[model samples]
Target: MFDVSEVTVIAVDVFGTTVDWRSGVIDGVAAIAGHHETEFDCPALVDAWRERYLPAVGQINRGERAWANLDAVHREALDECLEVFGVAGKFGAEARERMVRAWYALPPWPDAAAGLAELRRDFVVVALSNGGFAQLTHVVKGAGLGFDAILSAENVGAYKPDRRAYVNAAKLLDAEPRTILMVAAHTWDIHGARDAGFRTTFVERPGEKGPDRPADAAETTDCDLSAVSFADLAGQLRGARKGVDAGH
Candidate 1:
């Protein structure tokens, strides 16, 4: 129901939307645990660590806690998870810091790299994430993600679904809210951007939260466009652009 021709930029959510955080965190934690001859439920530990993410950011967004970047939030959650899992003493400060940096080394989803390249042909592609500037830069470079620009909630001193994050991204891109497309795997993310007057595109990422946990079916109707992967999204957008061009 929306016009692709109107979209001047595509701002994507980087965490679960573009990169697979669960697998990356699990791999990183398990590697560290293994090296230390420690035993714990790796998946459970990762899940527990991630479960703290939103609340940690929300504390800042709600002004209950002083502003902190995603790296700080992840470290806090990691420390808590280590204690809860009874593996706190297994790693020293250096090893724990390395584990926190695991967020930077996450792999992009299967469709992310190529699909992003395709979409970049017609629109400015950038990252809009809660991760700090350094964190996002590492991920983009490590994964070789070709974003024209990278934006972070750190820039606004807040995390999403805060409206300022989206608004500031639009302002940075010099585009109106309606002229930008917010692409994400999380419905809450899309909902936030849509509420901020930006168009939304929901990309389904199965197992974003955990294995076998696909994106909610209800999310399909909540956005201007829905696709199973970034490839499908690129195809749809390219076709829409073709139609617009032919008419012109």
Candidate 2:
């Protein structure tokens, strides 16, 4: 278990952890298909596109590829997805651009905004994501999630599961790795953070991968905490704070 009293800041993962990217991508792809008068399996396209995300980012993390922002990677994946879905050349340049930009406007999960607001009262809350600064900022503002600050892997030119990404976030916040809590929905992200000596929290987000492939809620010994939602996380933190204060 994590000692919440030692934590000074909470670094949140943006994409699948805090926002509903699956819904946003599906909607965006569906709109593009509709506009072009084409029939496509939007859900399959979204899944395929998202499957490319980690490997593309991993190539850069491993120094096998040059540094490129998530937007560029998304566009490359979009091209491949379009071809696979038999919708290539159906969209004009502007339409394709719009489709890639859909990531910038993802809506937050139902409990996200309110839960973060509650947590922010006691701890500094910031975004520590692989997304570009501009894209993260757009999502925060569009969703009205009121983050204390946004720190992207773009700052370190690497992606999560990379040590530099976690270390950079701690350095930027002027805190020790142990004093920063890394909260994410994906176990791989939690594993990375824990390996970097940061406390980890896994927020359960069913259907994060897809409706057919819902994320498992199995409790892992690797994580310090596991919560069903942001609201539940906030409550647990509040209780932990009280325990610390009373002991003090």
State which candidate has the highest lDDT. Answer: 2
lDDT of 2 by residue, 1-248 (tens): 56889999999999988999999878977887787788878889889999999999999999898999999999999999899888887887798899898898887999999989988988999999999999999999998896899999889998998999999999999999999999999888998999999998999988688879868463753789888887888889989989888989
Model 1, 83-142: lDDT tens digits are 998889899999899889888899999888998998898889999999999999999988
Alpha-carbon local distance difference test for all models: 0.88, 0.89
> Could you give me the TM-score of model 2 versus the true structure?
0.96
Model 1: ten consecutive residues of lowest lDDT: 212-221
Query: How much is the lDDT of residue 24 in candidate 2?
Result: 86
User: How well does candidate 2 score on lDDT at residue 238?
Assistant: 89
TM-score of 1: 0.95
Worst 10 residues of 2 by lDDT: 213-222
* Displacement of the residue 91 alpha carbon in candidate 1, Å: 2.0
